[model samples]
Target: MSQPLTAVSLSGVTKDFGRVRAVRGVDLELQQGEVVAFLGPNGAGKTTTIDMILGLSKPTSGEVRVLGIEPRAAIARGLVAAVMQTGGLLKDLTVRETVEYTRSLFVDTKPTDEVLATAGITEIADRKVAKCSGGEQQRLRFAMALLSDPALLLLDEPTTGMDVEGRRAFWQSIRQDAKKGRTVLFATHYLEEADQYADRIVLVSHGTIVADGTGSQIKSLASGRVVRVTWENADTEAITRLGGVDDVEVRGDQVYIHAKDSDTVAKYLLTQTSARDLEITAKGLEDAFLSLTGTTDSTDSTHSTEGAQS
Candidate 1:
């Protein structure tokens, strides 16, 4: 058979746990060698979606295919590998020992030493897993995932426990793997990471996809720009009444204005108020995400969609 043009295909997929609907009808298609970021706030069904994609959990309805085959069949062929966000580590083994043991699970495996080096953990090869820092352990997990050299790699919030430096180093290693023409999909809350690394992004909110596009395309979904004016006599309500303003927030001595046109907001602020420290900037992905989802990390609610999508 000819090679499938798609690396992953999900059609009308949904998942439920008892009474809770964790995923809605999520239809997505990813091509080979594409690096995609699956982004959402906590409890947005990101993990549930990944679980179904990995065949760890069955979908309640519809179908999921990886590499043009069912998820389980594709995984059984050693065509898929994942670096999960948590668990699946042997704490008692040293890094080298763990790599060796994990490699034994598959016939087509990379050398233990080579995998460790690729993951940037060669220097800590002898360190006990339990004693390693969170970042080191995460790298070890990544090394294990690479042992099979799978064509598709799935990473779920891969840098959750790392410091900023650790996150950067980890992405550098991942960047190399992605450059090798492997199809990779990673879930993350860090919008900047998605902006920097992913050629495409799929954003979920309330267990359903809200947006899917490249960084700039997603950002463009939000109209206009932002203008911030700092002054002691700013009127937050008056600014909200301006023709260009979409929303306004007031600080002690400043007002932040979200508007379709930054020029209009800035002009009004200058003409009407004695504002200083005026700045104008385009809307970022974070702003777009908030505007699209109608919520933020703080406002994430307990409500779940009921019996989503037949």
Candidate 2:
């Protein structure tokens, strides 16, 4: 078969507000059936970029295409939908009303009852929008976004005010929706959310795409292991002297060792010291983000890696 169609594409894309540049030469391609996490720190131009993708803002230069068409045309055909971070709901409307109004805008739409159920808003369907909590409002927006039954969904901080259980349920709904061959691209501050849920991660900083890959591959960018142990006195000096030990920190009775070869460090602790509660874990996405964004000054530049397994 020919190569799969591109669901979204960006090439040499840049955006500026007055004299302040918000996006810088960002390039990305999103294929169908992929769940991607667009990640960055505050003011990294994530919202601005999303605006361009949704045809809400014009790019200063370069191209953006959704399903082989400009975003406006694609959106008008019910090919795209977005659940933004805030400010879309009408305070006077009820959850059911909100969904119904949105459905009226689309020629073809999912049923409001189905949207309410899937979005977990059935219990509050008749409640006025202004009385709903932030998390509840989020679900209402989610219900509205689903009305179009779009091929792609864009979620910006989609779980901001949810409790732990609510967040879990929300993501579960997203997972089930993705089984239908729909694409999802979400921007979130919760790195662990990206780690566990996303099939691919795109890291941006300074208004540029810095890293794009699976969670495992991105974490591999900051290669190392953490050896955490509870010990009497910690033998801080001896652990620091061990081979492959890059750094050491001690808190109370516990010691955290950063090691390039954790096996060597683990061996020493097992045999030499009264080390207890030892745990070794590979560095995660947070470390990788810090490393790529200049904390550890990782050498990897803007790059994309496929075929990464969990």
Candidate 3:
């Protein structure tokens, strides 16, 4: 059998703007038909990397290929499409008209009705774009993107203004499309969505790829448990001095302790300190994100300016 094609590939990719380096030397690859989540905090070069892949911006160094060809070439052939967070909509047109207008820009296109239904916006096709809610408008954008029947779909914060039901429906459409051999790459602030939806998660921090794995595997990288207890007299400094403790936070009477040896911390909290109602749980994706990205630290100046253009 022939080898599966690579949908997107970045080798030694780096991007810089003046005095600041936005993206460090990064390498990534996504196989065809994979649903991958590209995750990072603000100024992490996630958007910059996406721009390079779309051929909207050139990398200061390295190569970006889409479908084994140049990014722009693949895009020009209607093999790749992107649904951005905002803009590209005409308020004066109805949803159907918006899609039809977009279709006109292409040499060949999927049926407008089919795209609308696939995007779950067929029922609102007659609604005026200006009158549509944010979620509805985003669905209209999805419909517009699907008009090309793209093999690789890049979604940048695709569900930003959507409600709970709207997000659910939107992802359902993406899942169905991915099942049909369409590759989907999305960036979102909602970590739960990535945990639930993505086949794999790629985490970038300070313009570099830090963690790449399944949600569970990423969580394991945190390597600790969080112990929560109600202790009015908890001393943060004292807790930090503990052998296994990594960090501690006190919120009102609730004290949260992150520790590698959770058993020892729990025992000490129950027997030594006035801490009560102790609960110990494994670190979650949020914990891993904060730990791996150094989001809680104020030391990295790179993030402060790297995403200025993002």
The number of the candidate with the highest TM-score is 3
Model 1, 1-310: lDDT tens digits are: 9874688889999887776767879999988888899988777788788888899889999899998888898887787899976678888899999999878877798788788888899999998899998778887888888889887899988778788887787777667767776789999888998988888999988778999999999998887887887878667777778786788877888677889978877887788788888998887788898887667543333243221310
Best by lDDT: 3
How far is 208's C-alpha from truth in model 3 (Å)?
A: 0.8
Worst 10 residues of 2 by lDDT: 301-310
Q: How many backbone collisions does model 3 have? A: 0
Question: Could you tally the backbone clashes for each prediction?
Answer: 0, 0, 0
Better of 1 and 3 by lDDT: 3
Clashing residue pairs, backbone N/CA/C < 3 A, model 2: none
The full ranking of all candidates by lDDT, starting with the best, is 3, 2, 1
Candidate 2 versus the native: TM-score?
0.76
> Candidate 2, residues 118-151: lDDT per residue as tens digits?
8888999999999998878887887788888888
Provide the lDDT at 228 for model 1.
Answer: 81
Q: State how far residue 52 of model 2 sits from its true place (Å).
A: 0.9
| Model 2 ranges with Cα > 4 A deviation | 225-283, 295-310
Give the TM-scores of the predictions, in the order they appear.
0.79, 0.76, 0.83
